[model samples]
Target: MDEFLKWYFSDHPIVAATLGADGYDHTLGDWTADAWHNREREQVRWLERLSAREASTLDDAIDRDLVLSQLRGAIAEAAWPEWRRDPSVYLGTIFTSMYAPFQHRLKPEPELVSAALSRLAEVPGVLAACRANLDPDLAAPLLVKRGLGQARTGRNFLTRTIPSMVEDPDLRARLAEAAEPAARAFDELVTFLETFECGGTWRMGERLYTTLLREREMLGYGAAELHEKGRAAWAELDARMQEVAVQVNGSRDWRAAMEFLMDDHPATLDEMRAEYEAETRRAQAFVREHDLVTFADGEECLVLPSAEYNRPVLSVAHYMAPPPLSSSRQGVFFVPFTPDDFSPDQVRQRLRTNAHAQMPSIAVHEAYPGHHWHLSYIAENPRTVRKVFRTPYFTEGWALYVEKLLQEHGYFDTPATLLAHLDFRMFRAARIIVDTALHCEEMSIEEAESFMSTKSSLSPGTAQGEVNRYCAWPTQAPSYLTGAIEIDRIRESFRGTLKEFHDRIAGSGGLPLGLAEQVALA
Candidate 1:
């Protein structure tokens, strides 16, 4: 058990350092082809060691649950081509490591500079690892958008973000010298990827896809059943949205009515921030006032603009939890502005996603009673396993579940807000259609984005980015609606207050929804 701590401690030293952990204060771990193969081998051994344990099952359920999550991931890491196909995995690692040391000063000044300098120097090696490891044949061509976007972000981050974080003149000078090579590395990556005459047939097919649902998410049904589930959700949400649109003085066609809400958004960027901040506070206050869910005592949230490192992956808003081991515990809720590099129409569309009517619900989802709230409780225990394992089904599901819960409890408070809330429900429902269809080889990138834009009423560029993510991740897109469906079922099955229901699930340590239901009822 103790070995597990040392083994897991800084496996991804930069990730650990980002979360304020030590032992990685001056290094970016190996990013070579051999290192990744080693990672796969280690995953196998860890799973074997975990399965070999001879404890009573009932007594060790929490540890077992955590291991189960890691076990599924280990299987996929061995089976899947992600380290090769997904450029974000490499790009994210490089860019994130460069700034993560500064994000958390886990050590004193001298160490921080040396750490940052060492990581900055290693950026070229990491990018080289990306080139060496990625098999162009397995790469999803649709993700070229992400690759290109990240290349731009790499240049921008070094020019803008890195300097601000590295305050010391000599350290800043070293980072500047290292910046050119990292930027050149990303540029070379972009040029290399563009040469491929490849297609994005990134399907998991029937059997393994179904196995992912059954084993990883603990679902009773398989891929085909979930397809029907998604289709049904899409139909139901659209109908409900049309019905709600009437209250907003919207046209009978819900799409036309949603346009009204889109136009009802904040006029300028500053106006948008004020609205988001105010609504964030409102959502936090409502959770506390209504006693909707338990908030972690003394946990504070800082509303900030999102980082440039992985923009398209994170999109408009994301939450950063306090390091599981940090003394200063505060979570950051990042709300990003549209990049100036985008075309005017792209900016308009991205801004609409941050529309006034939707901001409060987003506030609820990202901050109070959602990610920040859920994680705050999860952070209370010193359980390293929980920190290591997160199933999208539970994490994203809980966030969406709370969005719906708030609407049902009159948190929307107005017809415009009601329309905005439905907009997101339908958006998630649409991801079900797009995610499976793309991976099932039923749709092209164009077709998938069209489905998303039509279903969610988002702009083309915004929809393109959304579908771009689905191309990289097969089953994750469906987690939003699929997980919410299970939560709704569990909510109806159990006889208890909402707070009691959520607290029980929270206590279960973010189990997959099906297993969570079993534990919650038990």
Candidate 2:
């Protein structure tokens, strides 16, 4: 399994870089259709080879389950040939490559610039290959919009951010020269995506969606079941929020109260960063003071400005974790800044997401005992499979689970803070409904955005960002709430103290809830 894993990682340069593997540093993954098929074929081979091994032969239970899950996941991914269907894959990669330097802190400044320049030189060829590989007929309109947006961002990165991030005059010259062609290519690609668009549903259909849930996620629930549960959860959240609203004011109205909270926001970018930074320190201190769980030594989080390319899909804050296999453990908690061109009102609107009420819980969600804590713990583990296979169910679910855990443990001492925390819950609950409905073709793009605005506290801009992210990765948006609910359910049933259960969960290698439950219970 170790040899097979090493071969798999080294074969895909992008995956290799992401895992912090040593070799395959100077290359990108093959963008050709032949390479795509070759990867599918390789996954098939891995499945066969892993299946031939007996599960009982593996000494550790987590190891045994991980091997099975990894193989099944590999085979499941190839079942649909989503490489042809998912335009977001290519679109995301374009920007990821562009911002790889700062996002991952992959190398020294000189080495990083040279590597970036090497990659920038190949951007045109890469975009051309992606253009050839993508099927216009399978595209969701939102994807076309998203790809075009990112492509534009990439073009701007070549012209703008690249020149600024590199200080050396020689590097700047190389960057400028390489960026010109890449800039032209990205513009051409964006135009092509815009002009050659085709009409299609983003839904994977019941069959593919079912296989994705059952095979890929190894979950027992289906879209319809999850959707219904989401509605139920939303209703319950609304009911509780109404009582709180009545207590806070005379009326049991959610929107008015939520809007009031949203209006209380940082007035400037510095204020926003300062607020997130302060909340991060507070959350980390609270976790340690309370002994919520073990944190890695020096597992500190830094608040940085979001890359221009990522703000389209990311929310007010997103955590850029260090690669698990790497020795450096610093985590970046990225907060989006208001663009300089925005007027006072626009700036206020952009900064409203980090309102004082929600910043603490959001800080907990992104920094302490959330993504950063989870990844830090996982990095310390010796198992190779743990670093290689990341199930959104466990990683996302754990983070969401901690939100409620802290709330229950008296982290929110004020009505406003508690209300803000519930607001996040309501948002995630609404996301499951929107994600399933949008991907199942039961809801239109406009409807999803409208639903977010009406049903949750999200503004139109944030709502659009949520929907666009959902469009990019079907099933992922729903994972936050679904996984959180599942972990909550497991905790209720598990026979252990809170600390034991949480430690078990944190140490479970980020397995799917179904698998993690057994480990948690044991």
Against the true structure, whose lDDT is highest? Answer: 2
Colliding residue pairs in candidate 1:
none
TM-score per candidate, chains pooled: 0.93, 0.93
Q: Each prediction's Cα lDDT score? A: 0.75, 0.77
Across 1-522, the per-residue lDDT of candidate 1 in tens digits comes to: 557656665567777666566676567788777877887777778878777776676426666656765667568646766777767777877776666556645466557766666776777787788777777677766665567667667776875587677777876776677677767776787787667545545666667777888877888987778888888988888888878888777455788777777876777666776777888899988888889877666788878777767665656677877776666457778876666576767667777778888898789888878888887777765566665567888888888889989888899988888888878878888888778777777788898888887888777777887887777777888887788778888888888888899887764566777667876777
What's the C-alpha lDDT at position 295 in model 1?
68
Candidate 1 Cα RMSD (Å): 2.3
lDDT of 2 at 306: 82
Alpha carbon lDDT at 329, candidate 1:
55
